[model samples]
Target: MQSSYNFWLVGISFVVATLASYTALDLTGRIYLLASARLRHAWRLGGAAALGVGIWSMHFIAMLAFSLPIPLGYDFATTAYSLGLAIGASYLALHVATHEALTAPRLLAGGTLMGVGIAAMHYTGMAAMQMTPGIDYRPSWFAVSLVIAIGASTAALWLAHTLSNDDARNVLRKRLIAALVMGVAISGMHYAGMAAADFPVGALCGAAKGVNAEWLATSVILFTFAILIVTLMLSRFDARTTFLVGAVSNLNGQIVRLATLDTLTGLPNRATLTERIERAIHSSRRQRSLFAILFMDLDGFKTINDSLGHSVGDEVLSAFAQRLLLCVRSSDTVARLGGDEFVVLSENLGSREDAGALAQGVLDRMRSGMWTDSQPLQVMPSIGIALYPYDGDTVEILLKNADAAMYEAKRAGRSTYRFFERSMSEAATRTLQIQNALHDALAAGHFTLHFQPKFHGNGNSLAGAEALIRLHHPQLGTLTPLEFIPIAERSGQIVQIGYWVVRETCRQIRRWIEQGLPSMKVAVNLSPRQLLQPNLVATMLQIVTDAGVQCEQIMFEITETVAMHDAPRTIEMIREFQASGFEIAIDDFGTGYSSLAYLQRFRVKQLKIDRFFTNGLDEHGAEGSAIVSAIIALAHSLEMDVVAEGVETESQLDMLRSMMCDEMQGFLLGKPLSADDFSEMLRGRMLTT
Candidate 1:
């Protein structure tokens, strides 16, 4: 008799087989892409279990689909043994594939093992069946089925390796295609192996002892579908998470680039340039090689910015940066130190001539003129070069010397370059010494205040005095203001010095008040840096309050240059002082570019004529007389008084009095004297009056 096949059960088996194949292939893909070694091992184990269970379920379901003349049941121990075989074989196969590159030899070996394992499991499962007669097989058909299993296993491994190496576009689509192909191969092998088996009819066997075929098929279908759904979900989540991580990493890289690169010119910024210089220094010291730093400042760029607009200026700068990059070697670095300033670093230089040649090339290119928006604009470069181990060894020293050389180049001519000389280093050292000494002088009370007495223009009666700073160094001995004031200003020590002046002047005024002397307004000079201080008004007021002096008896004097530095802030500060009953005077009035409009706006009490006009007045010169007359008239019209400074002769005093100047201060009156001498002068003036 021939065996009857259940077409309905066969169709159900095929459907279950397809689902199991898809799940197993997807799990294998996930195992390949996991990053962490431990995580990858875990995924490999999970993938092996999934594929083994899926294959075993497909084989068992197909076994149930086969028809015989009697009822069928399974042997529990034999059935479990087949499942263990499938799991063990799958684990070994995945381990071999993932441990390293799946070369042809390794792929073939792994496939052979896996194929033989699956074929054995199928036959073992078949042997578990208990029916009227034992199972049989056709030799040729069995051989054909075994060949299909080995061929499908080899193809599946190759496909997995190809998918793992793929990095082209549409990667997800490619993975899905690979999954489908793998599913078909695995399912085809299972069906072919099932067709190889045979069962004879009218055969007597032992009574059924295990689960019934129908119930077992139902149970296997449910379990296999559940595993398929879970595996697919995990695969999708892993892919999405991997994509998100990659995106965040890419964004962080872009942010770092933005921080270190100039947005307008795409050159390294100041901070990045500093780091490069430090690295270059380290490398040069190790190699015993020389490097050069070139500091370049663009000439006439500011003119173009003012004539056209900042947008055009930005375009010009960008074009200049590109040309600079082309001029430097690949090993060199070019950086922008903001607004028309750039630095070029050349490392491992053989000689100074090489650096000079590079500088000349840059200067020639800059003088050639740059084109922006089809318009040619001319700009020149002033380059200063400092060599390593010769000019200076450190970054700060090299850059500072280079800057001094650049300024010297500018002073010599517009378009030129200069090499740092030993003299420049000496000058820089002297400047540093002066700064250090000034700090010590301020702390050691080596600074003194000299009060120059001012007198009423019409009468000999004394007006207030002007307080001047004089430094008495133990070694340098009695340094004047012109010698160290500029140094203090440059080193940002002026703010502290200015505050000291205010406090000392207030203390002197308080002493006079305590000594039963008449109240007199003493004027103190304010530097430009002092006026820019944010707490200027508050700090001055606190100092005066601490000295127990009335604000009305103290006058603050600022030069015309200071007033124009930041007009709005200057005016605001002046108004605050005036509101507190302190007088504001514009010192060195005629020397600066003080407009009549600002003069009217500022709530000042007096204008001090510079010594230039005062000295000329003694000669009765028509020009000097006219200017003095005009300034006095202007002051009167603005309700401000006038003072004439540097009056050293009787003629000058007479001329100032004729001009109706409110106060006069000069050697002819009473030269700047110590605080004690000033007090004696005031007492004598009172006695004579």
Candidate 2:
């Protein structure tokens, strides 16, 4: 028996096979992305049915293209049974390809199993064509067909697994390419099976009346394509639905973030902070352990925001929030409580001192911090702490008290922390009183400078004088810096006060020069706020130039703490002062922890021993004398002069002289004097000279 092929119908079979393969690949991909097992299983079953029919139809079409000399027809029952085999094989293939973990062993076993199913379905379909002289299949050709079927099935399954989850357009192109390969392979298997069949010259087909081969192929082709096209349409709809579901999920996540996080810093917002604090309070009560709530406000943050724009301020706040996160344990919560305010909830603290230590750690970072580029801003926080079970048991009470303590810190002088005290609320009134009086005092000539004379440690020769700020209150008499400086600084009036001090220092020096007294430098204190002023160097230089006072007539004194706090910015400012021929001095030195490296980096000409260290120099050959002697030696080695302040005794003066200290200032030498008194003293000394 012999068969001739209609090449066109054969090509049509290949096209049907490619269509089925492509649909299987696409559907498999869609099914895997689904979150629900039921949805995946349903789509898998439907896809299997469509692909099975399509495959069966492709085989029938290929067989129709091969016309035997004798008539051929398929048994309805056997053919229906073959269809069931195709569907079952397809379901198994889909399941294996879509398995969650397609490891090596799993893929091998799954491919082999699907291969066997494909071989069974192919042989079973072949058996449906019953002939009077039953078809004899050649052993070699039969084995070859069986091998081709199994190999094709295995390769197709592997391709399905590999290509199904790829969602990109390139993946779709790859899938189309894969479909062509699998279609050719399946066609090869079918043709090889057809080649294996041997028919006698007189053989008669038993199922010749059952179904005409060409008609069956045509009918099934139409049916299979209909099923595949509809299945593809459904898959498209399902994919769209899945995409919408994913979008909704993302929207929900964003909504949750907006509710819980600060819009600016992405830190927990006030509500989230409150929730965490409440939870902590509950846990703390259960454990009978203490926690702490720290409330912090940026010192002078408003000045930066107003002067540099909110954009810069926002960046500073965000950076500070990140720094706060770094300062805490992962278990601790840091949150922003609106503008310039933040909160930290520290759990399992050992004592109030531990909380204080935590606050100090944050302060240290701020003290050493510069927040942006192109004129970096120095940010220091005034922190207030309220301990759990001591300050308050409830969240509201704790937060309230912490805020109150923060205000107290602002009063005590910003850039420091304060524990909640019963007396803090009352101190607020006094602080307010001082702040109110400061506005008029500068305008009314109540703000005055008192000059304290510095003498040579080795002799009574004058070295210089430090201009101390004093406010003459009509009702309360003269008040020192300790009484009102903090208030003025917080109110940002210190910048104006600083300018006034410079002008007055220059004026007084000019008067002394004109009065025939020898020219001497007078040191004036610079607040950090004043340093933050734009064009500070030029402004001070202009003031001095306008006063007819030489640059050498003024020295700027900065406390060692403030100078080293923001060292990079301070070093820059000092360079400008030095370049302008104004000498810089470190006031209250030895009080701050300035490393020798930093001290050398600064271009200061003098180091003013803080009163604390100066007071220590009472007895010679004592620890005080040794420390003073070491400091004087250290200053001299650095090519810098030392000024010992608060020298109130003859013994301290004598000790300072023995230590080779360069300058001394105290009541024993001369007290801080009014401008007139200092002038009279200067004139008398000039007369004596």
What TM-score would each prediction reach against the true structure?
Answer: 0.61, 0.67
Steric collisions counted per model:
3, 0
Please give the distance, in angstroms, between residue 282's alpha carbon in candidate 2 and its true position after superposition. Answer: 6.8
Off by over 4 Å in 1: 1-291, 295-331, 334-343, 347-384, 388-400, 403-419, 440-442, 612-629, 648-655
lDDT per model, in order? 0.80, 0.85
Identify the runs in model 2 with alpha carbons over 4 angstroms from their true place: 70-81, 102-113, 123-130, 162-164, 167-174, 204-223, 247-251, 254-270, 279-390, 400-522, 527-550, 561-576, 590-603, 613-644, 647-689
Q: Cα deviation in Å at residue 24, candidate 2?
A: 2.1
User: Pairs clashing in candidate 2?
Assistant: none
Best by TM-score: 2
